[model samples]
Target: MKAWFARDYGRPDVLRLEEVAKPVPKPGEILVKVHATTVNSGDRRIRACDLPPGMKTLGRLALGWSRPRQPVLGTELSGVVEAVGQGVTRFSPGEAVYAFPGGRMGAHAEYVLLKETGPVAHLPEGVDMQTGAALCFGGTTALTFLRRGAVRAGQSMLVLGGAGAVGSAMVQLGKLAGAHVAATTSAGNLDLVRAHGADTVIDYQKTDIARLAERFEVIADTVEAMDFATAQKLLTPNGRYLAIAGTLKEMLGSLRKGPEGKRMIAGPADERIEDIVELGRLAALGQYRPHIDKIYAFTDMPAAHAHVDTGRKRGSVVVQVAQ
Candidate 1:
């Protein structure tokens, strides 16, 4: 087996391809022959050791005191069940599947081990490996956050950084939920956001955030590029601000909001097995679409990471691990 290991924390250059031992599934687990995976924001942040403000030391400790605890960086994958271990009856050999390894990321390779009852699901016959892999990261995150926000139909929603993976998913899901979606992005990516179903697109470079035309029932700042103190004025009463990336200060503020004030929601998306299954169903029905910004070959994993590092991808960046 071969895997791309981040030898150290720094840049995409730190990731190197090395032949390694293939892993077998443990009891209650299944062995997947990875067909495709993605370079998501989580992978980029870990590879670069990027941390939110005031959490640098904590991030280092959680990831590693000096280097990464795990060398492989992918968080989600679409693959085939090569074999199922003893006691695993949910999946059989040759079944196509997709999984979010969550905190146990080891998918940047030719093979991976996943628990049969974990966040793993059989891919729909209509969904290809690339789309399945692409859907895992952003689709799960967007769904998790919107549900947390208690978003409802006919309400207005605002998504900041609307052209990236999570943001694009947010726009599409918001529209699916029947909300009036507004999103912010660079002028170059405005059309991309619109294509994802954002009813109104704000060009961040040209428009002042405070001057936005309408207050929103839900505001999701996916990239942490906006000031919540000022953005709060843009929220309607009883609205919720979904802080996808919150600093320590913002977290504390979130905890201290007045009882009568709009709520501030900040937390990591919980990648649940049920959500994966639901997203898979939606994909099968053609209601959920995974837009690929670029596709890189397995041997070109480094280039894929480099592209993600640029922070400008309109949607998912997928790596084809097998034909």
Candidate 2:
């Protein structure tokens, strides 16, 4: 099997494509013949082993200390089951599926394994492997924020990176929940975000998000590091301040403030299998869809990583590993 492996963490150049042994399924695990996989900001961050002050120590302890604990970089994948381990009873060979291999990094190859109890779900009817490949992180991340924010009908939502993969999905999810959605993007994506259901568009380059006259009941931010005081000020009372991009300290600070407005903020919600399955249902229902920015051939994993690292992708970046 040919797969991209990370020998030492650094740039996309660190990734070398070579033949490697295909992974086998362990008890309760399923071996998948990968069709496609997608990259996320979290993937890049991990490759670089970039964590905030105290977080680095935690990562070192969990992953590898001196070098990368996991040699492969890909996380979310869409594939077909070639074999199901002994303890696995729900799925059989040849069933199409998708999943997040929770903390492990082997999805960027032709074969990867995961426990059936992980975030595995059958591809939603009419949802092809390409789209399924891209949904795990974007969907779960969006779902988590919306749930934590507890967005309700008729409320207003402001997504900081609306044209982005996760942000675009949030726009759709927020609108489906009956919220008037707004998103921040450059002039290029003004119409695109609107089409996704964002009622208002903020030119983050030209307009000051912190100074917008209209506030929101829920603001979903994926740009990570935004001023808490600024976002908090824009929320309606009992508003939820959700930021997947914000740092741990920021989230904790908002939580501790005990301020009004569900000012409750968080990232990556829970990675429950049910949540992913639910997201697939929503995609099948046309409420949420994969916003693909580009699809690169599996060998071009380096190029894909470079694009994601630039933080300029319009949506998710898909890597076609096999199909």
Candidate 3:
């Protein structure tokens, strides 16, 4: 099997493509022949050790002391089950599936193994592998935060960095909930975000998000560009600030302040099979879709990482791993 190994935490250059032994399924695990995967912000952050302030030691401890604890650097994937370990009755050898490997992060290769009980679901009919690979990172993240914010119909929600993976998901999910969605991104992505269902779009480079007159019932910062102070001011009374890409200061502050009026909420998205299943159903029904920015060949993993590092992608950056 071929895999991109992160030799050490640095630039995209550190990711070296090499022939590695294919992973085998353990009991209760299924081995998948990967068809597609993605280069998410989380992958870029981890590969480059882009830690927030006051979190270097903690990040080092959690990720690795000197290097990445997990050498492979991908989170979500769409693949076909090639084999299933003993006792794995839910999946067979030929099932089409997509999964979020979550904290394990081993989807950047031709083959990946996961327990059947993990965040793995059958790819719904009419959902292609490319779309399937793009959903988990954005869908699960946006859905988790929106649910936490208790977003409802007839309310106004603002999505910061609405062109990125999680932000695009926020725009679509907010609209599906019947909320009036406002989004901010680069001027080039305004139409893209709008297509995803944002009723109002703002170009962050041209306009100041803080100076906007309208307030929102839920303000989601998917790019971590907005601090809690500014986001709180933009929130309506009893609103919630959902920070998917928050800094360490905001995280610690949230623990101190807790969930109150215009409260701060910061955490990693929960990876659940139920969420993946729902997203698959929605994609199959054309109610939701991932906006693809680019698709690189499996061997071009380094180039894919570099593109993600540029931070200018319209939506998910996918890497086609196998046919």
Q: What is the lDDT of residue 141 in candidate 1?
A: 89
Candidates by lDDT, descending order: 3, 1, 2
Would you list the C-alpha lDDT of every candidate in the order shown?
0.89, 0.81, 0.90
What tens digits encode model 3's per-residue C-alpha lDDT throughout 1-323? 98999979998889888898887888999999999999988999899998887889999999998889999989999999999998999999989999999779989989999889988999988899999999889999988988888999999999999999999999998899989999999988889998999999999999989989998888999887788888777887778888888767767777755334668888778887888888999999999999999999998888998999998888899999998
> Which runs of model 1 end up more than 4 angstroms from their true locations?
258-260
Clashing pairs in 3: none
Query: Which ranges in model 2 have alpha carbons more than 4 Å from their true place?
Result: 258-264
- Cα lDDT tens digits, model 2, 1-323, are 88887788788888888897877788998989999998877778777777765567766787678667788778789999999888899889999998887567678888988888877888878998888988877777787777777788988888888887788888888888898988999999898888888888878899978888897888787776366677778887777778677666765766564467446576445787877898789888877887888999998999999999988888789999887
**Cα TM-score per model:** 0.97, 0.93, 0.97
Candidate 3 similarity to native, TM-score: 0.97
Which 10-residue window of candidate 2 scores lowest in summed lDDT? Answer: 261-270
Candidate 2 residue pairs that clash: 224-245, 224-246, 238-261, 238-262, 239-261, 239-262
RMSD of 3: 1.5
CA RMSD per model (angstroms): 1.2, 1.9, 1.5
The model with the greater lDDT, 1 or 3, is 3
**What is the Cα-based TM-score of model 2?**
0.93
